[model samples]
Structure formats: structure tokens, C-alpha cells
Target: MTLTEEFDQSLLPGELILLESAKLFGATNISPNAKQWEYTRKFPIDELRQAIQRGFGSIELPQIFGGPGFSFGTKMRIAEELSKFDLAFTFALIQHHNALVRVAELSPSDHSRELIASMLTGDLIGCTAMSEPEAGSDFSSLKTVAKKVAGGWILNGKKGWITNATDANVCLTYAQTDTSLGSKGIACFVVLGDKEGFIRQAGYELHGAHAAGVGGYGLVDYFVPDALVLYAPGLAFKTALQGVNRARIHVTAMNAGMLESSLSIATQYGENRRAFGKSILEFQGLAWSLANVATSLEAMRSLAYRGARQIMRGEDALDSAAIAKKFGNEQTLSGVAACMQAMGANGLRAEYPLARHLAAAKLLSYTDGTVEMMNERISGAVKKRYVL
Candidate 1:
């Protein structure tokens, strides 16, 4: 049996089904063209439609919202399984889910509810635009402003490094509503892509996750009616922070998937390729390297699942999520790199996915939160609780 098959057999029924769905979707639609799509930096809309048709887009939301009502942990496992085959495609879907979850949680307006209904049906694509060029790690200093108008607000600013920027039908955007209040001044809004002054610029030439359509846009006097305002200044920053802290666990799952795939590829290559009159797997140094990576991958999985479980139990997981995010990113980068080195030059070739995995590992480090941000979260807690 294949390695994936062996792994699936060990899972529970629901998890087995999720893994099977991801495997089927990847084998039939995504895995074959991942390289071509990456080279062209073009997302596969047709494949995405297929994914939606299969109901993968609405995994964790409630059935009332057209979702399958899966638990957070189940959804995270599905994310891990899907990303193992195609990280870019999986990343795009994750971005869609992010917008849906955040909007569902923070938006209390009638219009936001209608948009959520549309998103659940897969008729609308949603994305979050939270990071700006100048306000990445320090979001309190974001230059994007939302000024009150006669009947609504005029948003004037630019957001960079947004996933699904060019093609999403709606955006969950944040802006400074009261600059004098610093972090408390920030507020979230629901901005429709077709509205006047909402302009989508060209996508970025990213080293990895090309199919994710990560790009920037300029909102030149974009008009947002009061009905579209999700959270006001006093509550917006807290909502966004909590949403991101939860989302970090999903990011950890994606990285774990990548590390799993990288290890599988490296193991197969080492066992088959011969050097010094024997398979590379027979060498003590190479075998020990693989052992170390495998250990790290398991540890990452444990941490990610623990964080998910904590969230499912209605507990605060800020510190757990931060630890998982930081360790997962660092370890995945190191483990994937080690796997590539174990395979020698063949791993660096386009024919193999090690090069792609390496690029993605680097990209994952910055998304959601930077390694520095994660460090701050964890260290702040440590100092508060343990310092004399």
C-alpha cells in the first residue's frame, strides 16, 4: 500500500473520509498541473469550482450557513491532507475559509449575513485584507483610513500581500477609524470588489504559493456604507486578533502537510537511489537525518492538534497557537531543507517538489504572523506569568 493509504487506515472514519476526499481531488485535478500553474502564477478557477462542487469550501461553518458543520480539529486535519498534495490550491481555499469565518463571527449586519450566505453556497469568493506594506507586524500604525461621510465611510488606503486579491468577490478589510486611539482605532469593514474606487492591481511574483494569487490593491476613496461596517473601533482590533490567533492553528496544519510530503519524497528517493554501491538509505548519516525530520514532523502534528483541541474546548489558545505557529514554521523549514539535502541535486531539480516546498516553507513563516510576532506573543506571556 502507498504511504498515504497506510496513514489513512489509522485515522477515524470522519478523518479517513476527509483524507480520501483530498486525495481524490488532488489526483484527479490539482497535482498534475501544480508545476505549470506555479510557473504561470495563475490559479485554477475550474479546479476551484470542482472543489466547491465537492463541498470542500464549506467545511467548518454551521449547516445553517451551508457548511458541513465539522469541528475545528476535523477541518484542520482536512487542511493538512489537502495541502500535502497542492499547497497553493489549499492555501487559496484556506484564505476563502478565513474570510468566511471572520465575517461570520464579527459581522452582525443584515448585509454581512447575506454575504455569508452567498459565500457558503460557493457563489462568492471572500478574502481578508489586513496587512499593509507599512503596517504588517505593527498593525496599529496602518495608514489605511476610513473617514466618516454623509451616509457612509470613505476608505482611502492600500493593502499589500493579500491572498485572492484579484479574484475575490468580497474583502474583509481593516482600516484606522480613529488614528489617535492607535490599536483601538482600527475597525473592520466588508468591502465589495465591484464597488466604485475598489481597484485590484497586479499580483506579486512570489517565490511560492503562486496559485494563491497573493497581490495588492488600492482603495481610492472607496465608499463603504454603514450597513457594511462589521466592527467599530472599540471592538474591531480584538475581533481581528482573536480570529488570527485561531487561524494560526490552520497555518500550522498546512506546514505539517508540507513537511509530511517532503519527507515522503525524500524517503522514497533515498531508498531507490544508489551511492557508493548501496542505497543512500543505508548510510547512517542520511538515515539519522531522516529520523530527525520525522521526529520533528510528529511533534509539529501534536502541537497543531493540541491547539485545535484547545479551541474546540472553548478555551483561549493564544499562547498554544503562537508556540505551534513559531515552531511549525521553523521546524518545517529546517526539516524540508534537510530532506532536500538528503536527496542531493535531484531534490533541487524542477522535477522534484523539494524546491517548491522550500519556497513555501519560507513563505509560511511570514503569513498570518511573522516569526517575530509569534515570539512576542509567547515571550510576553512568559514574562507576565513567570518573571520574578
Candidate 2:
């Protein structure tokens, strides 16, 4: 069997089906011409539509809600496989779960059922609005306000660096319902993209993950119905932290997959290219560097797998997830850079995956949280073990 197949069989029966769905999605979305697409930032939307049509977006909700209701292990596995090709595509599609889960958390059973059904069938492309112009990482200090009105709440603030911002039909926004409560006063609301007082704009030029179509949105005192309120004040912070931690794990896996791609390219180059009348693989310097890259790749993958398993086991994986993100992103950038060096000028050229992978890995180091943030989280956890 293929490597993917072997990995699939290692998972539970439910996980196998999700993996199948992901494999099908990957086959349709990931281009053999990935370099061309990366350079151009023009993805094949029809392929995305095809995957969604096959129910790729709604595999996590329960059957009672018309969702496949796959386990966390399955979700992680599916993300790993899909991100192996292109993280941008995965980012664009996973919004369904993020949005629907929030709906389930804040809304009643009937609303959850209806929203989840729509989420799976491509009718509800959703996004989270947490990062404002001033509150990218420090969500507690956000100035966005949600004030009570006659039939709904009025929203006023700007959201920056949002993924799937333009494409999403709905956005689950977080705004401070009461400034008196500080972070504890924050609350979540469901805002339609075309709602009154909502203004959308393009974001600044991003380096990598450009295909994700990130943008900015301005809520010029937008109004959402009282029915649209998601989680109340106290719950917003809890869910934001949880979602970010979960996203960190996925970022770890994406880095792992990108590192593997880079190493594969480097090894193939070493085996085929020759210098000084000998193959590069036979040269001690190139061989040793390749060895280091391979070792680092395995180590990062090991860490990410542990984090994924922790998520699978239904345990709190925040600290472990942060560690995995820290190590995986650092290792991926270093490994890809080394691979580029091994390839000489060819690696620098756009024809190679090394350049694109290196860029992508660098960007990932800061996406969910920076390496510095991960270090802080890990250090704090360590301090809890004993007085230092």
C-alpha cells in the first residue's frame, strides 16, 4: 500500500473515511504545478467547489445535525493530509467547522442542527473575527464594541488580517459587550457579510499563504440581531484561546508536511546532481546536511503526532500544542533553508519547491502564534511544575 494508505489503515474506521475524503480533496486541489500556483496566487476555485460538493466541508458535525460527526482524531488526520498539499486551501475550507462549532457552543440545539447542516453543504462559509487592527494577538485589549439595540446588537470595529474574509458568507465576530468587564466583558456575535453598516476592504500584501485570500473588514456600527449573539461575555475569551490552541496544532502538522516536501526535493537533487565528477549524495558535506534535515523532520513530526494524539484522546493539549508549533515551525524553516543551500542556484529559482516551502514555513512561524509566544507559554507551564 501507499504511505497514505498505510497511515489511513493505522487510524480507526471512522478516521479512515475522513482520510478518504481528504485524499479525494487533495487529489482535486493540490496541483502538480504547485509552484506555478504559488507564484501566481491564483488557485483553482472549481476544484474547491468540487471538494465541497463532495461534503468535504461538513464532516465533523453529528448525523443528527446532518454532519458526518467525525472524531477529533479524524479531523486532525484530515487536516494533515489536506495541508500536505496547500495550507491555503485547508484554511479556506476549515472555516465551516470553526463557525459551526461556535454556533453549537452559543446557539440552541435547533440552531446548531440547522447551522451545522448548512455548514457541511457549502451553504455556510464562515470565519472568526477576533483580530482587530490593534488586537492581533492581545485579544483582550480589543476596542470593538457591541451595544444593545431594539432588535439586535450594534457592532463597531475593524478586523485585520482575516482569512477567508471576502469569500465567507457569515462571520462569527467577537466584540466587547461591556467595556466595564475588560476581557471578561467580551462576547461573540454572528454577523452576515452583507449586513448594514459592515464595510469590507482589502488587506496589505502578505508574503505567503496568499492563496488564502486574507483581507480586512470594518464594522461601521453594524447591527446584529439579539438572535445572532453567539457566546456571551465570559465565554468569548475561553473559546478564542481554545480555537487558537487547536489551530496551533494544525499549523504544526502543516510545517511537518512542508518540511517533508523540502527534504524529498533535496534528497532527490543530491542523488541525481553531480559535482567534481561525483554525485552530490556521495559528497560528505551535502550528505551530512541532508541527514540533519531528515533527522529534524522526523523529530518535528514526532512532536506534532504526539500533539495530534493528545487532541484525539480528548485531553487538554494547549501546552503540548504550543511546543509542537514552536519546534515544528523552527525546524521546518531551518530544514528548508538548508535544502535550498544544497541545491545551489536551482533552489533559489522559482522552479523549485525549496524556495516556496521556505517562505511558507517562515510565515507559519507567526500565524497562530509566534515562536516567542510559544516559548512564553511553555516557560509558564514549566514554572508551574515547581518554583524556579
Candidate 3:
């Protein structure tokens, strides 16, 4: 049976519909089905083109903007299932909307229409142009600059670790308005991918997300018109983290999906193979390890759904969302490892899903917000109650 068929029978009907829709959209460009993201490292433009043709690019925009206006719940469901298939592909799709949120929140209505139209028609792709090589976690240390000029602005300095690099149609970028204001001096800019002097530099041949084919940009006097600005000077960085938190939660759900995929594959292998004169599941130790995976996965789903519901209700789930993200990523990794061990050496083989699941957990856990950052956020919440 196809995975979608299995999904329909296993997931709730509503969830099944969402997954089927995403699948039909070809929103995922991850290759090898059960293995790794092959196209990204090499820039699988052909498959990506097919995905765009399938409407993968416009999944979340408002209908008037050529998007589906899907609820956060629906998005979370799609992200989780897509991550089960391919994390890099899921990451690529989410970056576009993450970039769009700035436009949605601040762009002039006309600019909004233009950008949203491009997004819907697959004429525009986007990348987040934050994160210099030196300013990993300490965003305050970011040094890219944007200087105002007549009728426009001049962007200078390098943007390191860009996911889509120079190939994207646009970049949701942040730059320093004035060094005197430091991190708070940061202003957001919407720069076109084809802008002059905006060069994508070498690097980002990564240890993971290989299909991402990541790189960076060296912005040398790239002039972006004031017409292209998404947020007013210094506004985006102030609110930048809210978007990051949302992405973190989405990434957590993706990790949960990957782990879920691996666990099912592992369990099937365990049941089929004989170990010590019986299936590995027959061993009490192995059985209990499998039980841990089940319990942890259930917990992950509960927390993720709670976070999604809380967000939909406009509740403050920042701390709780981080907790869910951290919990799901951590537990999923532990479970994948356990399942791998239960499968013996065969689990380490590329054909098995657990290996890729472990890699995916590592990627998501570190990418959106580090687990340590999540802990600090949680600690702040605790401290706010005078319990730190």
C-alpha cells in the first residue's frame, strides 16, 4: 500500500485529508522517498519546478493572495507529514511564509499584492538573510549594515548561512541602521534576488540538510529601493523572534514526524526478524524500548497539538511551544536510537529510516532554536514566577 493509503487509515480523517492535499500539491521535493534529501545539495531544479507546478509554493497565502489560507493546525499537520518525507523540503517551503509574515505585517498593500502574487505564481522564492558567520546565537552581534540614501537604501556586508542563497527570488533581510543603536538598530529590508552587487559566497556545504545546497551572500553596495522595504527601519529585528519561535514549533513537529516514520519502520523490522530464536519484540528489553518510543511519540503529539491549539486561540504559548519543540526533538532522537539498537546493525543501514530520522532530529533540534536556548526561555518563564 502507498504511504498515503496507510496514512489515511491510520491518521484522523481530517488529518488524512490535509496530508493527501499536501501530497497532491507535491509540496515536498525531498528525494529518495525513504532515504535522504538528494536534490537540495545539488539543487534539484527539475523536481522543484514540478513541485511549484503542483502549487507547493502557494500553500499558505490567503486565497486572494493565491494561497490556501490554511489554519495553523493544518499547516502544522502538513509540516509534520512532509517532514516525515523530507525535512529539507519542509524547511524550504516554510522559509517562504516566514519571510512573507514580515510583508504581511508591514508591507504597503500594493507591495503585499505584488509579492504575494509572485509567491503564488512561483515567480518568487525567498530566503531569510539573517545570521552572519560570527553572530550565530548572539544575534545582537550582527553587523550587516543598511544606509539610507535618496529614494532608496544601500545594503552592505555579508549574509552568512543563507538556505536558498542567490537563487531565491527575494530575501527577507535585516541590517544595522546604526552601530550606535547596536542590535536594536537593526532594520529589515526586502531585497530582490537579482539586485546588483548582491553576491552569493562560498560555504554551506553542510554536515546535514545536504539537499538544501546552502550558501551565503556577500552584499557589497546592494541598492534596494525604499519601495522594496518590508518593515520600517529597526522594526523587524524587534519582532523577529516571534517568527523564529513559530518556526521552532513547526520544526519540532517535523522532527516528531521523522521519528514517527522511523519508529514504524523499525518496529516492522523487529517483528519480522528473528533474534535469539524469536522476533526482537519478543525480548522483554526490546519490547520495553519500543514501548518508550510509543509513549514518547504520544507525548510529542499531545504537546504539539496543544501548542497549535494554544496559538490558534491567541494564547501565549511561547514558553510552552519551546518546551514542546525541545521535548519532541529530544525524545524523538532517543526513540530513534532505541529503535535502531533494537534492530541491531541493520538499523544503521541507509535503507532503514531510523538513520535518516536521527539525522533529521539533529538538524531540527539545532536549527530553529537550540535546545539550550529553549531551556533559557523556559528558565525565564520560571524566573518570572520568582522560582528561578
Candidate 4:
């Protein structure tokens, strides 16, 4: 069966609506030349803006805030469907959605109402800046400091590997207000890109997802007045960790979509290309490999949707999210590699998407949180709950 047939049978009406919207957006704007755009590192700003205007990216925001107010399961399906067409482009939209969600959580504040309005109208772009060069996985080691001043706080330090940093209109940033307290001293703030002392620097030469603007920046004594502070000291990291549970769910959905796409490509190629007096797929080795890929995809989807259901019910999902993210992302890489191997030289070609899918998998594996961190979290949770 085809991807659509499988999806149509499984998804609800609301979920199908978002999937159709994503397919239309991808067909019109992204799928045609996604490879060339990835190669040239050119972000499709106008197309993406149109997508946001069409309500494709902000579905998770509450209806009170001009969003569709969909369930978390619907959000995951949206990410998965969009990613099947283009991982980098889907990622850009996912990042924007995440920022909108963060703004919603931090609303009723001075700047949030206006900012969220602008985001829904596509007048602004949003991103998160938390990772620094020296503080990849260890939030405790972040050196960016927000020194309390007479009027407000003076921010200083640099952040690296920030998605959408070069193009975002606003950033949700975290910094230490009291290094003596380590992670406990961390605070969050809303920093406008056009503001003075907020520098947008160039990102590394990337292998994939160039359109996502994975870059870095420095805050040179940037003064953020009290009005712009989102989370006070001792609360920034808490908010960040709270956000991760949902982010991991979307990340898993993205990986599953890419894996399904890769499998489809391999399946189509294997049926048509013949060797040894028969189709390659007729061989048990290749046939079983594809079967295993399908099985793995189903397993990942089960884990991801279980976590999404928990989140929808307002229950704790950290453990489920970690398991889904770690297993989903890791399996996506392996599955996509198998698909590429099935296609042989064609998979390596830039014209095909397998190679780019591999790059996207690697990119996601490191971001959000690493597999090692997930293992630690699960082990800790298990020990705390199961100890007699």
C-alpha cells in the first residue's frame, strides 16, 4: 500500500485536514526544488511566510490566540506529513510552531500579546537560543550571563547552533543571572533581533537543512528591560525542560516521516529495477529488509502517538517522550541507510533525497537532547519509581 492509503486509513478527520494542508503547501512551494535549495543554502522565506499565513505552522496555538487549537496528536501528524516531502522545510515550520507554543505558555506578559499576534499574522518569525558553543547538552554549563542592572538586566555571552537565528525576528533566550548558583541562576528573556547589542552571526557550512538557518550570535551587554523578561532566575531551565517533552514528540514524528519517505523510494525502485533474471525485491534478503523497515516505522509511530495522547490529557510524558525520541531518531537513521543501500548509487545522488534524509537524521539526533541524555533520564525515572 502507498503512504496515503496507509495514512488515510489510520488518521482521523482533523488529522487528515492538517495532512492535506501540508501536502498542498509542499506540492506548491517546497517539493519541486527542495534539493537545489538545500544545495544552495537558500531559505524559502517568502514561501514559508505564505505557509504561516495559511495557518499551516501555528496549528498548536490555542484558538483564543488565533490558532486551530488542535490536539498534540494532530500536531505530530502534521509534522510527519510535511517531513515526508522535505525534512529541512518541514523543520523550519516546526521550529516556528515551537516558538509560537512557547509564546503562548509565556503570555499575559507585557510583550507576549503583541508578539503572538504578529507571529500568527506572519509578520514575525520566532526561534529559541539556548545552546552555546560550550554548553551543548549540559545546561548547567551555560556561561551567558544576565547581570542585574539598575534599570533591568544587561545580557552578555554567545549562543551557537541556534535554528532560525539568522532570520528570526525574536528569540527566546536563557542566561545565568547568578553563576554562583549554576543552573539554578538561569533566567529567560525575549530579545528582539533588531535591538542593539543583539548580534546575528553566520552559521557553520552545513551539509543539510541549510534553509533552517542553524547559526550563532552574541549578546554584547544587551539591555533587556524588566518588561522583556519571560522567566525569572531559577525558572528558565524549568520552563525549557517543560517544553522539551512536546518538542521531542514532534521530532520523533519528523523522523518517522522521513523514514517512510525513504522506504517508499526504495520500494518503488526495487520493484522496477531488475537483476539476476528477476526484480531485486524478489530476493528474500532485500524483501525482508523492507519488511523490517515497515515494522520499525510502525513501532516508532506507536511510541510517539502514545506520548502525544498523554500530553493531550495533560499528563506527564517525559519518560515516553524520551523513549520515542531516542528510538525513533536512531531507527530513522538505520532505516534510511538501508533504503539508500537498496538503491545503490542512485541513493547517493543529490537528485534523490536519501542522502539529505541521512543528514537530517544526524542533525536531529544531537539537537533537543542526545541519546545518552535520554538514557540517563529513563534510568533515573525507573530507579526512582520502581525501587522497593
Across 90-188, the per-residue lDDT of candidate 1 in tens digits comes to 888878876786667644667767888877666788888889988788877889999999988999999998988868878988999887899999988
Tens digits of lDDT, candidate 3, 305-349: 777767767787788888898898789879889989988999988
Off by over 4 Å in 2: 1-10, 106-117
Model 4 per-residue lDDT tens digits across residues 1-388 = 7433553556577767776877787767777778877878887777778888878778878888779787677777777877887888778777888788777776486478888988887678888888999998998789888988887899999989888887887788899998888888999988888899999898567989887878888999899888778888888888789888888988898899999999999999999989999999999999999899999998988787778778878999999999999998889999999999888888899877889999999988988899899999989889989994
Off by over 4 Å in 4: 1-15, 106-111, 385-388
RMSD of 1: 2.8
Error of 2 at 75 (Å): 2.1
- Candidate 3, pairs of clashing residues: 40-211, 41-211, 187-234
- lDDT ranking of the models: 4, 1, 2, 3
**Superposed Cα deviation of residue 109, candidate 2 (Å):** 7.8
TM-scores for every candidate against the unseen true structure: 0.93, 0.91, 0.89, 0.94
Give me the runs in candidate 1 sitting further than 4 Å from their true place: 1-19, 105-114
- For residue 17, model 2's alpha carbon misses the true position, in angstroms, by 3.2
Ranking by TM-score: 4, 1, 2, 3
Question: So what's the TM-score on candidate 1?
Answer: 0.93
User: Model 4's lDDT to the true fold?
Assistant: 0.84
Number of the top candidate by TM-score?
A: 4
| C-alpha local distance difference test of each model | 0.83, 0.75, 0.71, 0.84
Error of 2 at 155 (Å): 0.3
